[model samples]
Target: MAFEVFKKSSAPVSTVPSVTIQKRGLISLNRAAYELIGSPEAVELLWDSDRRVVGLRATDLANPDAYPARPQSAQSNRGPILVAGSLFTRYIGLDTTEAKRWVPQVEDGILTLDLKVEGQPVSSNRRGTGESARETK
Candidate 1:
């Protein structure tokens, strides 16, 4: 029997829209999600307590309540859209001790993050080891 080597594909990354709420209250929107929201410079964070869903709506940068959607890095505008959302997270009573990734759905010109949906825990970068940082509880 001949041994075959495993090969990795060089295909482009997924286009499915995804959003992540980091442990430090940073909201990150992948390229697909950013484009789905019209790639605005700012967005308004909305909350529905009854449904426990968070909504994001595009708005002008001048809007006082608007959160600026900045590039993940200064060198790349094509990267994820990052928003400082500490106040918003605290207001919504979300547990920020751990990071979570969720797939968002868009409706009526708004992007929504349903808390009811089970989110995948994002691994922490702080650990030098490559192990997942899942909650002990």
Candidate 2:
């Protein structure tokens, strides 16, 4: 009888774009999502109450409605993109009791998340010790 050796995989991480709305209202974007928008430093949030959709449009930092879209930390260049959205969520009356993840669609340079579409619930245990949504600058 011949025994086979166990091997570890070195496959690359998933590049499928996704966005998460944290329990505290922070918006987290996966690497693919970040790159989909050309990696902007700021974004303007647009809400469509009628359609129950949230949109993210890249904009200059000087824009009054611009929100900072920065990497999780300086140490990891490939880390998730974080955006503080506590106020925006509250304004839109979105329930943030649990984190939710959804696939985004881009149209005319705007990334949109349709709340009407069911979102995957994110386990709290998987969340990192990053900035909270309440800490928006």
Candidate 3:
């Protein structure tokens, strides 16, 4: 009585080492506050030593789905974690150059990112080169 739909791909999945954000100094300190927080205004900023990431607790200006909007009875809930600096370096191996590219711009009260993908195309076909798989050097 029920059915599920699925899509398949033969192309090899590729990922970028890192993305560069153009025109905004390397990694703005308030990047997370504007982007993830959904607004430049914040109620409080806490350094969560446990997660090694800053926690940005939202006030009334936060998004409707923000963690703070959850019922107070949900004692097990935690706010969002803002990753940066060594925290990103340790976890995502974010280098200085990469870290510097992580910036967010605020326009008309909305946060946005301007980035471009830079990488080589990956072929999905498994067939050995045009010559032959057993070709000798």
Candidate 4:
């Protein structure tokens, strides 16, 4: 399942926006490469666009919203998208800001936000608040 990012309210939280829908039952990229072009004896290495040895990380490119992993040829409907994030943001404070911390919400509707207080370096335990609704101005 994939995660969804939603905006909390000081009054009351509401329905989440349909940004990136998650899917399960697909093979991972690693496994795909092994089946796609790997040898029958050894595992191969992969490089990024920069020609550097890439490592597993939490990035946006491998994410559903950014670049969701495609399903494998074998598993048609029950495959999971084992995605990874990419650190290729050209700007800072874009989504890692106080009012724009994008959290991952499971398909079951369980959201896990990596948020902190505004202007704080993720140290303050202010947590969050609940607002009514944005439509009620």
| Per-residue lDDT of model 4, residues 29-112, tens digit only | 323232232212221112233322222222234344343444434456433233323232211122432222222322222222
- Give TM per candidate: 0.81, 0.80, 0.22, 0.18
Q: Tens digit of lDDT per residue, candidate 3, span 1-137?
A: 75433212222122211212212212222323333544333323234344333333445635543322222133532222222224323343323432222233333443333323222222222465685323421
Q: For residues 21-128, what per-residue lDDT tens digits would candidate 2 score against the true structure?
A: 988799999889987888999999999999999999999999999999999888988878999999999999989998788889998899999999977776543334
What TM-score does candidate 2 get on C-alpha atoms? 0.80
Query: Best-fitting candidate, measured by TM-score?
Result: 1
Q: In model 1, where do residues sit more than 4 Å from their true spots? A: 1-13, 125-137
Instruction: Check candidate 2 and list the clashing pairs.
Output: none
RMSD of each: 6.0, 8.8, 17.5, 16.1
The lDDT of each candidate is: 0.83, 0.83, 0.31, 0.27
In Å, residue 126's CA in model 4 sits off its true spot by 40
Give lDDT: candidate 4, residue 9.
34
Instruction: Candidate 2: list runs displaced more than 4 Å.
Output: 1-13, 125-137
